[model samples]
Target: MVIESLWFLIVGALMILMAIGRKFVERLPMTGAMVYLVVGFLLGPACAGLLTIDLQCDVALLRTLTEAGLIVSLFAIGMYLRIDLSNPLWRLTLRLAGPAMLITIGALFVAAYWGLGLAAGPALLLASVLAPTDPVLANELRVEEAGDDEPLRFALSSEGGLNDGAASPMVYIALALCGVHTLGSSNPWTFALAIAWGLASAAIIGWALGTGIVVLVTKLRTHYDHALGLEGFLALGLVALAYGATLIVDGYAFIAVFIAGVALRRQEMKATGEKPPNEVLESVERGQREEAAKDPELAHAYIAENMMGFSVEMERFVELGLMVIVGSVVSAHWQELLHWSVIWPVLFLFFVARPLGSSLSLVGSSMDRHQRALSGWLGLRGVSAFYYLLFSLEKAGSATVANLLPVIVAAIVLSVFLHGSSATILLDRYLSKR
Candidate 1:
């Protein structure tokens, strides 16, 4: 534990450096994730023998930590998102994210079952596990909340936001097929609960809670401000409560958290009692916008900004810790990555599966050749994939999952290195040039 604390201090310093000097860090091809991951590898028994973790033994703890990280990060993604869904581009996001994601899953399913010769259950698990793109790397990718967004960035960010939640149904379906859950022909009600109601319930509750909190805060601003300077911090409590409460009832907490962020902004607009409803909310945080005016609304906006700020800082740290832990988790098998089983699955998923689904989904849409290409190319997968696979592994405990772990880890490593390094460079090269 002392060794762990020391390592945290070292990584903590680096995180601070990365936070303040992102401009400097951005100039290098080396990403902060790469740095933290390397640190994790070195501290791990694979090298220095300072940190050791057994994946099979510690799966539950890892699952809880990773899931918590994914949830709050999802909330941050939702908080900053200011997409104009009425716009064709946002609707195009629905096409690219929803249908395109499913197509990717189907292609992967065939690859796993036919090419890799896995059983139906394992194949389904493999497909759904890798289906969602991540917004955890959003800041590095220059992913931002909705407002004056170009089609490509907006498409990727929005896709990352919704698809994380959308992928839950596929995971449940996979679980059912894996015989972990009780849903094969024998349980229709359970099927509806897992596939349909979970996601819908999260959305409704998220929307209601988000709207209700903002309205209540607006109504009792005097009581809120004087009694609690933490109206902003209150959001953290609310988000945590939202997540826990939703999950207790088996709702999709990820979607609920994200939707709550959006709902918060929407409620803010309505608290004024005259929203054009069509006009997008100001994307550059409300508190910062009203800082100069000192209006009655500033207090509310101020609290919201604090919430947003806290979420962002927390999300970054959580992502960093998870990557480090992941690096160490695979340390035991470090030298055995030469085989086809691991290589083939990752190779097909990244180069073949993702691109095929993404490109085909964008055909004849409003976007031009370049936007479609960039969107397809930037299907950056991360936390959401790991979260589902870990949860599934614990739930099913299939022997097939043992085979799946190395490939999943390898794919994520490949993605973090290639995609993280390229996020800024590619954006500048293609989008800037355009």
Candidate 2:
């Protein structure tokens, strides 16, 4: 009873503090994720002993929490990117999420196999898990608002959004190598086919549901004047629907959720005929509220904006809860982290693999050298990696989890400290220079 009470007290106090001090915190080099992680560490047995988590025993609960966090975050990431699909800016996303991602995976796989002496399956699994930049923790480096498609931020935001889903195929492939039970047959050719189907079908499912739902809602609100003012509920419902629908066909649910957000926002753009200026967006949204159901464009803008707002709120909450959980998990696994095998790969990932791969990938892009360097530096890994780790635990079993947990935890902590502290300061200077 006392422990439960302490949980409430700690959470309530932290929320109040974070709410009141958000702007002040934003000015510091540290992130909200860092603060939450510290608090969670303090709550762990190594400190105040108020919290404990047995990774092996609590795999299901952790998996559910992390999955929920990713679902909300990926949807928000898609909604936040208000750029048109044909904008040359998309090339940047592809560069980072595609070849750059693959290169990073390959680099890590080589390191894990040769340097760390892991078997082929485990090496690939580790590489695949850590491949994508995090959507949740790297919010400071993302596009601040819809329609603010600044090249660096847009590229980072879109890359984070797409790669989380994109990494799903590689993870499944690695699992197949590990002899894990997965969606289809376990052979290489069959796995390749499954990957192709999952990616293609998930994209279709997300697009159809995302685009279709908004059109239906807009029509109902327009002609019948029903189903209005529930944008938050609509956002949650859409993510759930897209996820379930994708999973039903054995497709990648993360991709479906992300593309759903992008499609929803695209529909809004179609309704408005362009990406409205921020001032225009605010005016239209205000007009929408004052005179409900009067303007179709206004409804579209309001729905998209409100849904994006709700998803962002959910994203922050997820970051706080998950960071704390990550901190606690680190507490439980500190010994494993001290091993030489864990430390070197993290250093290699940050110093050599990511930088080399991303920089090489961006060689022909529009970004200047400085921007490319920062982009490579800021591939923050967080909730997405944890989600995959927990997922592997459930599917691939406890032995895999034991082998992978320490390095994953080390990498996430290193990122939270390294990227979290540097992002705001570096971004401020980068923006000031620009």
Candidate 3:
């Protein structure tokens, strides 16, 4: 009873600290990722005994929790993206997703061979696993105001959201070749089939949920009497539905969430006639026209004011989960620091593999030289990297790779601190100027 009570207290305290820390980090121009990471390290076994609660043997639980977090984070990312598919932005997303991912994988594979002396299979596996950026962290860097309307910013935001889902197949394939699991046969075609199935499952589930919500909401607005806050509840329900449905179908829930968001946004535009209300939707429009008022910033502020806060809460929950899970996982394996092999591979991943891949993938794209450079530099590893690492290790049945978990966790902590802290300042000086 005492132990259980202590556990509850610790969780409650961490929750309060996360809330305070999130608000504090936002005002300071540093990222919440950095603070959470530093906090994790401080609470880890190396310092205080906060996360000394051991769970290393609980691989199944770790994988399940991490998977759930990944799915939630992915869905939220998809829902938040409000870009139009018909625009040039979609093309740019493909360019970044395709070339950038390929480059990162290729470069890391080479690095593994020359730098780490790893076999081709493991090198490729690690490269593919670590290639994508975490949208959960990337969204924190987004312009806060609605209608900030910078094309480049939208492109980066959408790319970050979609790239991880796109990279899933490649990561799975790499793992299969490394003899990790028999999700599919070793043939290239079989691997492609697995990818197709994952994507198809997600797409079908997302479309069903998205379409169902929009139709239901339309009916509610047209025929039923509902409160103003019902829309927000419906939105949250949609997110939950998308998550649950995808899991049931054995699909990638992250992809489903994103697709669902895109679908809902499309429906919104359709319902609203793709324009801000001139008179019918807003009484303020009449007053504005009478006064000949034309303040774009104020218009944006009004829209943001009317938006729901549920998405923000979802983002916070995912961020907290990432930090705590990372803390617990790392603390459990604190003894691995003595291993040079683990350390070297992680270093190569951050400094060599990712940069080279990003550079190659981004070449000849619409993004300017500065944007490309900043994007490469800011491909900071976080929850997604850890998720893949944990997933692979759990399936690998070997303690050799299992020992590397702490190193990866430490790398994520370092990334959340170093890159997350520097993103805004560096962007202003380098990419923003260009």
Candidate 1 local lDDT, 44-148, one digit each (tens): 888977778777788899899998888778777776655443558668768876889999999999999999888998898889888789878666553443343
Candidate 2 lDDT over 228-251, as tens digits, reads: 787889999999999999999999
On lDDT, the leading prediction is 2
lDDT score at residue 328, model 1, on the 0-100 scale: 80
Across residues 368-411, which tens digit of lDDT does each residue of candidate 3 receive?
Answer: 77776666677767777777776677666544354435556666
Q: Model 1 segments beyond 4 Å from truth?
A: 1-5, 182-185, 188-190, 222-224, 270-294
The local lDDT score (0 to 100) that residue 53 gets in candidate 1 is 78
Q: How accurate is candidate 3 locally (lDDT)?
A: 0.63
TM-score of model number 3:
0.82
TM-score between candidate 2 and the true structure: 0.97
Q: What is the C-alpha lDDT of each candidate?
A: 0.74, 0.88, 0.63
Clash totals in order? 2, 0, 5
Ranking by TM-score: 2, 1, 3
- Candidate 1, residue 163: the lDDT equals 88
- For every model shown, what is its TM-score relative to the native structure? 0.89, 0.97, 0.82
Quick one: best TM-score, which candidate?
2
